[model samples]
Target: MITLDLIGIGSGNPDHVTAQAAKAMDRADLILVPLKGEDKADLAGLRYRIIESCVTNPATHVQGFDLPVRDPATPDYLARVSDWHDAIALAWEAAIRPHLRPEVPLKVALLVWGDPSLYDSSLRIAERLAKRLPLTLRVTPGITAIQALCAAHAIPLNGLGAPVTITTGRALRETGWPAGSDTVVILLDAGGAFGTLDPTGISIWWGAYVGMEEEILISGPLAEVASQILETRSSARAAHGWIMDIYLMRREPALP
Candidate 1:
């Protein structure tokens, strides 16, 4: 049987790696890291650094594999994503099978960013693998980008007795603010979706590279800092060649 541990390493910060995740890494016979190409090489490097810091077991082996890119020509969003995930699962199996020996039980670990239960698809991809292999899956939860964003801004996640909506940038842009939710946390925004809404009564707490050394934060009335955020985000993406950011917005008159 193959024991697959999906360990969440937190949002780009080594300090955020949980004790349980570290222990799993130390126990694993092999760890797989995905390289998302040159534009995001730092992401793979961070995973390697985390493994180096956490795994003291000399018997543990680390391997890297190239991740598959989603085909944009597929047109249907869900279909494209499904194809991409299947490809990823295939890549995982190809990278893992050569290293496994039938003589002994094997444990393989994949370090995931943030909690697997959140927007991450690692668990889904792992599920696909389980259908094809004798696999037992385990998860070790880590801090999410939402938690990091709130902690960095020193703010409560929601107003008293109020509902908070957690969603993607595309949803906010296409559907506008969700009904009955005064507080919204936006993630995976490839574009500044907040720009589509009127900034009049909204206050934004935004951060890029949230817990990393290159972290950038800008918070204020959306009307006041919206342009600044766009400029900053653009400049940072240009400098680093990639970026991951999240933000929280709350309308005024929040419960005291």
Candidate 2:
């Protein structure tokens, strides 16, 4: 049997690795790190740095493997993602099989960027891998981008006794503002998804490379800061070759 631990390391900050996450990393026999190519080497480098700082057990093995890329040729969005997950599960198998033993329990770990359940597909890929291996999954939740974003801005997630909608940039672009909520938190924004909304009454708080040394924070009424955010986000992405950002939008007094 295999015990697969998915440990969340938080949003790019080594300090964000919780005590429990560190313990899970140290306890694992093997930790798999995904490599996204030289263009984003820093992303993989950060994971390696986390592993180096936390996993002190000389017996713990760290292996880096190339992550599978989703095929843009696939017509349907969901189908493309499903195929990608399947390929990733196969990648996991190839990386883990050599370490397996007959009728013996082994522990494997993977460091996740954020909480495995929050807009992440690691758990799904693990479950897909379980179809071929005798596997049990354990999750160690860490601080999410949403939490980090709010912390960076020193703002609450929602208004007093109010509901908040959490969504992706694609949905926000396709559907505009969601109903029944004054506050919305968006993740995985490709940049300027908020521009699709009518900025008349909304306020926005945005952050990029959050919790890291390169952190950038911006906030103001949507109309005022929208251009600044777009320009800043573009420049930041160009400078770093990669960017992870989130934003919170609220229509105070509610959008009628």
Candidate 3:
């Protein structure tokens, strides 16, 4: 039976790893780090940096595997994602089976970016493993991108006594800005999703690579900074070869 430790490593920052996550890493026999592509090699490196900084014991080992690419040719997005997760689970099994010991339960840790609960597929992949094998799963939560995004800008998450709606870029684009929302936090945005919304009276606070040393923060009226954001985001992505960003929008409410 595989003992899986799904450790949230936080937003690409070694310092953001919690004490519990550190201890979990120390106990793990193998830490499986996924490489998305050449563009995201830095992300894998960041995971390695976290292990270097946190795990002290010599017993733990870190390993890397190329992540299975999602098939973009599939017309159905949901089905495509399901297939991708299945492929990832297969890769996980392959990585684990070779290193397994019959006497000792395999302590396998996967360092996930951001919290595994929010906008992450690690849980779904783990569920697939559960169906096929008798395994024990443990989750250690870490700081999410939302928290890092707000912290980077030094802003409160929501208005006083108001609720905040968190949604993805696709949902935001499809719905065309949520109604009755004082504050809307958007995640996993590819680019230019904010341009789909009405920018006249709204304010935006945007952050890329939040909590990392190379963090970029931009904010102001949506009309004023939207183009600047697009340009800056593009330039940064070009320089770093990849980017992860999140932003919040607040619309003006009619006076009582």
Q: Model 2: per-residue lDDT, tens digit, 1-256?
A: 8999999999999999999999999999999999998889999999999999998999999999999999999999999999999999999999999999898789999999978999999989998998999899999998999999999999999999999999999899999888888999999888888988889989999999999999999999999999999999999999999899999999867534
- Assess the local accuracy of residue 30 in candidate 3 as a C-alpha lDDT between 0 and 100: 93
TM-scores for all candidates: the values are 0.97, 0.98, 0.97
The residue-by-residue lDDT of candidate 1 on 70-160, one tens digit each, is 9999998899999999999999999999987877889999999989999999999999999888999999999999999999999999999
- lDDT for model 3, on a 0 to 1 scale? 0.91
**Ranked candidates (TM-score, high to low):** 2, 1, 3
Clashing pairs in 1: none
Could you list the CA RMSD of all candidates, in the order they appear?
A: 1.6, 1.1, 1.1
**lDDT for residue 242 in candidate 3, whole number 0-100:** 89
lDDT of 3 by residue, 1-256 (tens): 6889999989977889999999999999999999888888888888888898888989888889989999999989899999999999999988888887777788899998888999999999999988876789999998999999888888999998888999988888888787777899999888989999778889999999999999999999999999999999999999999899999999887689
State each model's CA lDDT, in order. 0.95, 0.94, 0.91
**Poorest 10 consecutive residues of model 2 by lDDT?**
247-256
Query: Where in model 3 is the C-alpha error above 4 Å?
Result: none
Q: What is the lDDT, from 0 to 100, of the residue 253 in candidate 3? A: 79
- Number of the top-ranking candidate, with lDDT as the measure: 1
